[model samples]
Target: MARQCDLTGKARQANHKVSHANNKTRVFKQPNLKTKKVFDPESGQTIRLKLATSTIKTLDKLGLSKFLRKYYK
Candidate 1:
């Protein structure tokens, strides 16, 4: 019997010495984030930003609106 990697759809037996050739730890980092807000270099106006880890579900709950963004300024 073997354990399959859910992400890459690969199969490997349990604790069978994962080699550098089959390294999976280099995939991603924990702090997968981006700038929640970007300030203008000149006028400092708030620009709506897209952070990869900040998905829609979290935004919907945060009520991240244009007006609400004023607080950051």
Candidate 2:
């Protein structure tokens, strides 16, 4: 499974690490993703999703159904 935020579409970002000598090394900045089980009150089902911490915070505020209704097409 990829490290991504399911709700926000956040993914890895590529960049270079620069050293004192100006040499660059390729690197990836991955989102803070965690596997969580979110329960949908309307459906009475628990969904497992990989989401960023920020998304989780938003979900905590708006709830699963409202968040899904607003975000999911």
Candidate 3:
């Protein structure tokens, strides 16, 4: 599987690293992702997902069902 947030689809970003001499090096910035087990209220089951930290925070606030409804729709 790719390094990405399943819920938000956050993926690695291309960026440049600048040195003191003004030389730029290409780099990839990866999102903060974690494997989490969230409970589905509607289904009454736990589902495991690879999610970003920010998405986890939002999930905590909105819950699994509400968050899915808001974003997936």
Candidate 4:
């Protein structure tokens, strides 16, 4: 699986590192992603997903269906 946040679709960002001598180096800024098993009380099922910490917090507050509806739609 790719390193990405499933809920928000956050992914690695491409950037350049500049040195004092004015040399540039390519780098990737990856999101902090974690695999989690989220339980849906309405569905009575647990779904595994990759999510960022922020998404996880929002999901915790809003629940699965509401979170998806609010963000995905």
Q: Summarize candidate 3's per-residue lDDT along 46-71 as a digit string, tens digits.
A: 99999999999999999888898999
TM-score of each: 0.24, 0.84, 0.93, 0.87
Kindly list the per-residue Cα lDDT of model 4 for residues 1-73, writing each as its tens digit.
8999987989999999999999999999999888999998888999899999989999989988998789777
Candidate 2 segments exceeding 4 Å error? none
User: Candidate 4 overall Cα lDDT vs. reference?
Assistant: 0.91
**C-alpha lDDT (0 to 100) for residue 61 of candidate 3:** 98
Clashes of each: 0, 0, 0, 0
Tens digit of per-residue lDDT, candidate 2, span 1-73: 7788887999999999999999999999999999999987778889999999999999999988788789886
Q: Candidate 4: TM-score?
A: 0.87
Worst 10 residues of 3 by lDDT: 38-47
Query: Which pairs of residues have clashing backbones in candidate 1?
Result: none
Best by TM-score: 3
| Stronger candidate by TM-score (1 vs 2) | 2
Off by over 4 Å in 1: 1-17, 20-46, 53-55, 65-73
How many clashing pairs does model 1 include? 0
Q: What stretches of model 3 exceed 4 Å from their correct place?
A: none
* Candidate 1: tens digits of C-alpha lDDT, residues 1-73: 1233221223323334346797544332233334456455457587655344434344455545542464345
Clash pairs (backbone) in predicted model 4: none
What lDDT score goes with residue 8 in model 4?
90
Candidate achieving higher lDDT, 1 or 3: 3
For model 2, what is the error of residue 43's alpha carbon versus the real structure, in angstroms, after optimal superposition?
A: 1.0
